[model samples]
Target: MKFLYIFTRSAYGNSIAREALDMALASAAFDQEVSLVFAQEAIYQLVMQQNSANTEKKPHLGVINALPLYDIDDIYYLAEDSSTYNLPPAALVPQAKALSAEQFSSLMSSADRIQSF
Candidate 1:
């Protein structure tokens, strides 16, 4: 089955983003076609310079960076959402793709199942 995960969770707050990543990874491990999209504030999670210095939160950057190793390489960020929040593509993690709203919608349509967090 093809699975698409859309995560709009705060980058720092709780474990929502982490849980999304974990679920995406698990889905891929089962040999399922999995994709992930970051929209709204969740786009901030891809910022290359995430400073967790002030908080005791474990920076999930390392985990986010490991998605390819887990075979969950269909990562994307919403352009409209990122622009609304003033986040630029340049600020994203290395090689992370930015998609237009239309492109994102098209990707969503191709998904057999979609779960948002």
Candidate 2:
């Protein structure tokens, strides 16, 4: 099955990011095809220089970085959002690829199941 996880929330001040990450990992562990999309503010989760110390929340970057090891390599972000958020390619995690708006819509249409947070 094609499992698409869409994240639209920021990493800090919420549990949604963690929840989606956990579900993605679980889906991959079960040998299902898993892909992740970081859209809107969720793209903030991929910013490299995050410090959860002040937020009093555990840094999710560790698990996010470890995704590839779990066979969850099909990660992506909304292409235009990078420019909108002023995040250059260097500012984000390396695993995620850029997907244009049209491509993103096609992706959504192709997925067998989708979960958004």
Candidate 3:
């Protein structure tokens, strides 16, 4: 089965972002096909130079970087949101692809199961 994780929250200030990553990793470990979509403020998770240690929050980039190691490389973010936030694709981690709204919808429609955070 294919699993799609749609993340729309900021990486900090809450546990949902980390919990979503955990679920994706666990699903991949079980040999399920998993894909991640970062939308809205969740795109903040892909930005570089995050210093969450000062806030006592766990940094999310490390877990994001490990996605490829677990064979979970299909990471995407919404281009509209990125532009709205003035975040260029170059400013984000290399593993993420920026997709248009139509493409994002197509990808979401292809998933067998969807989980939104």
lDDT of 1: 0.86
Give candidate 1 misplaced runs (Cα > 4 Å): none
C-alpha lDDT of all candidate models, in order: 0.86, 0.91, 0.92
Candidate 3 off by > 4 Å: none
lDDT for model 3 comes to: 0.92
Worst 10 residues of 2 by lDDT: 12-21
Candidate order by TM-score, decreasing, is: 3, 2, 1
Query: Comparing candidate 1 with candidate 2, which one achieves the higher lDDT?
Result: 2
TM-score of 3: 0.97
Write model 2 residue lDDT over 1-117, tens digit each, in one string.
999999999898688788878989999999999999999999999998999998888898998899999999988999899999998878999998999999999999999999998
Q: Give the TM-score (vs. native) of candidate 1.
A: 0.93
Please, what are the lDDT tens digits per residue for candidate 3 over residues 3-96?
9999999898678989988999999999999999999999999998799888787778899899999899899999999889999998999999
Alpha-carbon RMSD, each predicted model: 1.2, 0.9, 0.8
What TM-score do all the candidates reach, one by one? 0.93, 0.96, 0.97
Best by TM-score: 3
Ordered by lDDT, highest first, the candidates read 3, 2, 1
